[model samples]
Target: MAASFQVISKLLGRLSPSISHPLRQYLSCLQRLPVGSRPGLSPFVPPSRSLCKAALPRDEDAAQATEARLCYKDSPWDYLESEDYIEKYGTNPVWESYRRNHKGGIPPQKTRKTCIRGDKICGNPCPVCRDPNIIIHHQNVKLLQQFISPHTGMVLDPTRTGVCMKQQKKLHEAINTAKNHGFLPFQIPFVEFSGADYSNSHDAVGSTPPPQSLTSGETWYKWYSEITPDENEVAKVKKTYKAYLK
Candidate 1:
């Protein structure tokens, strides 16, 4: 192979210097190439990218946060007392800082039906829904207290509080439960008791006179005998309640 390459190079050199020089360089490059590589194919080079993606940042704080959230979920009342709560919300109610996002100058008439639906959650969740720590429970009286009006002793409206209907419903049930259990005060409207209602002096409550003996064919009361319903009115009533009348 060496002798054949030498002879071909010499013949090409003798024939044309310009063409021979280029052919010689080409032949030299082919010879220098590794044994198994075919003429047309380029050498393979692995990608610069790694086989696996770079790991994301993991912090102890993240784990602690999740653990803290779980603890709050178990006992939501504790979260109200926690330092995190103080730092985040201070002394104000959970709904105090919340402002609903709206299109124009006037706000919406009602809060959203729900903040979360299945796994998907909306952009602006209600006060109860946005915070994972705020779980509705009858026992969480402190959390429930924020939702109640101090003056009226009534649960705050969903529109005013920016609470979703679903959470508001839950708030109502929990508040009622708390009130029933005596954890919270039950509001009773003030009414002046009338002595007349308790007394039996009223005509309706007074003892009736002895019944008048009547024949079997006669009605006990004269009014019953005098009750003459108009035929047209009776017929109209029967027609109006045709399905119900037997």
Candidate 2:
């Protein structure tokens, strides 16, 4: 519309003075009047490029996300001790309130193989995978303790904890590592010892008799030595290997 107006103005300016003088005066009068009073044109408001730019995530937000991942990766234990942990789960395990999304009242027999498949993540992912801050590490004993049973001291099952199979495997490995490194304690079953346990007098512990095979380089059992291959099979074997048997 602005281009059309400019073209008309130029055409008028090039015409003979008789017609162009009055039109030029009218254009000057329109320019002097407020934009709102203009007949065919509305206000020329600037484009909202700033608002569009603001709608995108800032560099600081990306940096913060990177920093958060690094924090969890480097020292996951710190997140367990941080105020954020307390606020999100005050004195409760990470999986305490988590419920697996399933159909009907009866739950599925097994948890998902993995919460994340490549670049895609399934809805209602397991607690461990859902939170980037909850990193699984052998050194993160405090976090590992949450998945363990207080009474039994055993790692909680995936069915009870609603953890995906992949995360459950990771939890098992981390817990095992923690126990091996003395960060976590494992219960050792106690057995009553008897004096005979250390003794070598029992018949079971006595020296075994030498087998006939070792004594005479013969087959161990009479049946093994007595059996012979069928003549037809022997002939077939010989014929098949005739080229290499020599």
Candidate 3:
């Protein structure tokens, strides 16, 4: 009976070691992994759909809030009319006021009255008025040439020319019209000179004879020859003027 008990005890010891070995290995693997690494485990809990929807912004509400404080501004050309210009600057020649104001800062705007009033009566004389009969027209090539620089094809500035804004505008328009019509001379012409004769003697210098006179071809007008005056005719004119001189 004692021998049978010993054999049973040995068999039980062998089974216990095999079961414990696998359990120890599994526990060691679990310890090495991060807290939330296990599959099928809920690491985080999401908020409700109602809370998420409340946090979003409405696009229409933001757009409406920004629309009330805006305003439109007019361009510089918009002040070309007499009324708008008068409000900003008084009736005065643009060129005169431009020079005065420009001394310190930028010039003021030119009103219609300033350009309309003749320079003789008006306090200021604009660039256009200083020269008479300087009409700004497409046909007026001479007038247009004055506004443009001969050296450079650039248009002269209002300050340099002393012209009012109105005249400047008209001048620019005339120049453009002339250019379009092919009236203005765009290209400058070239000229060539022959070398001078350097002969020493007066006879040698004057050796070239007078050009040969040709016959009056296709005679339209009468040609008169040199008239020789008599000595007696000259004595009568001198005697008549002698009494006036005394």
Top lDDT prediction, candidate number: 2
Q: How many residue pairs clash in each candidate?
A: 0, 0, 1
After superposition, which runs of candidate 2 have C-alpha atoms over 4 Å from their true positions?
A: 1-62, 195-202, 205-246
| Full candidate order by TM-score, most accurate first | 1, 2, 3
Off by over 4 Å in 1: 1-59, 210-246
- Per-residue lDDT tens digits for candidate 2, residues 1-246, read 457668768999789999998877877777777878766633435666878788667867878878988877888899988887899999989999999999999999899999898999998999999989898999998889889999999888899999999999999999998999999998998999999997787778967767543566577676887888899999999999999997
Q: What is the alpha-carbon lDDT for the whole of candidate 3?
A: 0.56
- The per-model lDDT (C-alpha) reads 0.86, 0.86, 0.56
Question: TM-score for model 1?
Answer: 0.64
Window of ten residues with lowest summed lDDT in model 3: 68-77
Q: TM-score of each candidate?
A: 0.64, 0.61, 0.29
Top-TM-score structure, candidate number: 1
Task: Give per-residue CA lDDT, model 3, range 1-246, as digits (tens).
Answer: 335435545555577778756645644465567757633212224656767676455555555434321211122223223353456444543333443223346664543334455434455557555323234677756556767888888788776656777778887888888888998867656767545445444576666777666676533333434445678988898798988766
Cα lDDT tens digits for candidate 1, 1-246: 557668877788787777788878877987798767636422324554444333222456678889998888778889889998899999999999999999999998998999899999999999988988889999999999999889989898898999999999999999999989999987689899899979987889988878788888899777898889999999999999999977
lDDT of 3 at 49: 79
Q: What's the true lDDT of residue 40 in model 3? A: 29
